[model samples]
Target: MECKNDYLCEKQINMDKLFEYSNRLIKETDTKFFRYMYDEINWKNRMIGLIGPRGVGKTTLVLQYIKQNLNPSETLYVTAEDFYFVDNRFTDLADTFVKYGGKYLFIDEIHYPNLNKIQTFPYNSLINSYSLSCQF
Candidate 1:
């Protein structure tokens, strides 16, 4: 099913634009910091967490990994604070994203309410619920 709200559509489109922009940002930046985390982190895991104070390069690392490791066509990167999600539910978004062949969901700002809640649910809930590898 598709969203009834047109604003959500526009926002989602912009979100896609953001992902493209993110890809360019990753490509343009100097990511030497990626050497340690890129090689060290087990990207094969179903769920991975990066915790640190603000201004750290966590988002850059995830975007770089997505750019280098995953299929850009099948992956999605959404920041939790997007106003689009205020009306568009995360569960519904996940349903639609996976329904459309979305494989990797890289969510930034996971400490936000919606994502933090997902973290509390059973591990299999995400993996089993949506055949998608989610990283926060």
Candidate 2:
């Protein structure tokens, strides 16, 4: 029981930090310059994949949408390269995020994570059941 409590406490702490980082990024984004495809891509879609060259504002576009639209607490923005991935699986993060009431998950640089982990059963099962709007 004590060990489980400690794990839960640690998870909450990590989530708090993740949300803080996400909010900071959203706050810093200026929606003034909208990307060309921003409007074309339907935000209503469950999974939105933005493919483009580097420095083309893919991350900025999603940040703008999250800032202008979604509730901060319900949405989480994480990059595949985030330090959390070092000790955690992507599916585990997704599961915990959902448990904490996360509705939208924006994983920038999605290609950076291990493809096998992202394609595993638990991850697929989570997305199928949850209202996840993943942006890669």
Candidate 3:
């Protein structure tokens, strides 16, 4: 996808060749769930919050939607538990990512306490975090 800031953006490298092979069963099952949610969601201009007990497949549902609808290059999947996140600032990563054309960010385990303080990061990037947390 083309971005306004060419200097900040670079070509996306699809390192995971696995994305090419369409898994019929996974797609079908994910689609069924997406369809159900689609019927329930008004995606036009609303934020969606998916909450449930652990291991109930909430993350699976988000990943499935991103896989089916968006190019992998335009998205970034991150988890608060990631080692890199321990010492890294979410705002810094988000600024670098968005300034480079990132569109969707799928963050898991965001209920972590570290992220709670990130809502006060002095940057536009924290807006998404706050919005997302509020939605949650």
Reference-based TM-score of each model: 0.66, 0.81, 0.56
Q: Candidate 1 on 48-114: residue-level lDDT in tens?
A: 6666655577777777787677777677777766664677656655655675577777656645424
**Residue-level error in angstroms, candidate 3, position 63:** 0.9
What clash count does candidate 1 reach?
0
**What lDDT tens digits, residue by residue, belong to model 3 across residues 43-122?**
33324445556776666666676656665655666665655566555565565556556666555666543443455443
Instruction: Report the lDDT tens digits of candidate 2 across residue range 27-67.
Output: 99998888778789799877766665667778888899999
Sliding window of 10 residues with minimal summed lDDT for model 1: 124-133
Give the runs in model 1 whose Cα sits over 4 Å from its true position: 1-35, 113-136
- Inter-residue clash pairs, candidate 3: none
- Number of the top lDDT candidate: 2
Q: Which structure among the candidates has the greatest TM-score? A: 2
Q: Sorted on lDDT, highest at the top, how do the candidates line up? A: 2, 1, 3
lDDT of each: 0.61, 0.74, 0.47
Residue 128, model 2: lDDT of 18
